[model samples]
Target: MAAGMLAGQVALVTGTGGGLGQAIALALANAGARAAITEMPDRLPLAEQTAAQMRAAGGEALALPLDVTDLTTIQAAVDGAAEAFGGRIDVLVNNAGINVRQPAFDVTEDAWDSVLAVNLKGLFFTAQRVGRRMRDQRPAGGCIINVASIMGLIGYRDRAAYCASKGGVVNLSRALAFEWAAHDIRVNALCPTFVRTPLTAPLLDDPVAGGDILRRTPLGRLATPEDVAAAALYLASPGARMVTGQALTVDGGWLAV
Candidate 1:
């Protein structure tokens, strides 16, 4: 693999306390980018641990606290990252999101709002802030990767809120890509099927839900964090210079059926 694909670049990835977010951050760092690993204040230690691992592997990394629900801190986080890395962030990975697994009717107003707030609203504002930074910076060219899900493309039984939020993310990526193309900023979405992460462990452990997921995926397997990380690396690298306003599905052929 080409380790220098992202050499000298700076990347900020949110929700990096564990799972896919941490995997993406580590992948970026391994690809020779200075990675900023961030998460909620309470999860800052996890981010730091990931950063430490990156550093141990001879990569540059920074750990920061970020809560996507708080709009006021978005700018600060982005600005701080840029300042820490010579005034530019080449990649923005909007990976901080949440889900509420409830049937449409059973979902309370609070559940709906919370899911949308982090998954949709937070993602938009974070990209907006980062897009502005990319636009204003000299030699402007940047990438934005939104971590959506296959649920956005299709539907699930008890994931009404999650499905709605992710579906919005899919379209939002397109809108941002269209509007930001002139600035040389590429915005894309990554849609992955069920992965065996802490976040999805509960769902994947259930006999019915897990069986359904496996049945739908032609490959009869779940995605690994590395699977999603590889796709993210491609989208962020120059190899995908022409790719934007697209959702790269990392499912194990779950959408094929």
Candidate 2:
């Protein structure tokens, strides 16, 4: 891919304190887009670190406090990003999500609510807010990349709520894409298999669970943040202009079986 494919574009990525979100933010910046790296209030410092890295690499970036679960914060972050980027937000990356691993029979209301709240509800509201900005901007239209998971396509143990939330994201992307097509907005979901991140370290480090995952995957390896970031860059680039309402999987053939 050519460098600076996204020159002058502006992007807002949620939950970008570290891991996949951080990777996506960096990739966008490297592609010549001004990045708005957002995280929870307490995690803002980490986001600042990411912004600093972008600057060191000769990219523009800024850190913002965003708690997706809170509607106020979502609106604030969106407004701040647009204001900072000359009243335009070309890309929205809904990467903020949480998972609660529990058996169906043992799942509690709180656990289910929390997972859905962040993964689905927060994603929806954030997209809605960003979509509004995208629609009203001078050259109305933007790309939305929702970071889903392979679990959305295939069921897995101890991920009931996660599966449901990601499933919702897949369908929601379709619905939004169709609705926003007239406005030039494109919506898509990015689904990746188990990725090597701090959040998944515990599971990936467990011999029993990790071995089972690798055995099931045709590639026999967990995805890296860069793997998923590349897909996101494609979705946001001009190359994917005709692509929308699709769930692009970076699962290393995990779903082929």
lDDT of each: 0.92, 0.94
- Residue 179, candidate 2: how far off, in angstroms? 0.5
The segments of candidate 1 whose C-alpha lies over 4 angstroms from its true place after superposition are: none
Per-residue alpha-carbon lDDT of model 1 for 47-99, expressed as tens digits? Answer: 99999999999988999888888987887788889999999989999999887
Each model's TM-score? 0.98, 0.99
Which residue pairs show backbone clashes in model 1? Answer: none
Clashes of each: 0, 0
Show the lowest summed lDDT stretch of 10 residues, model 2.
196-205
Which residue ranges in model 2 land beyond 4 Å of their true spot? Answer: none
The best candidate in terms of lDDT: 2
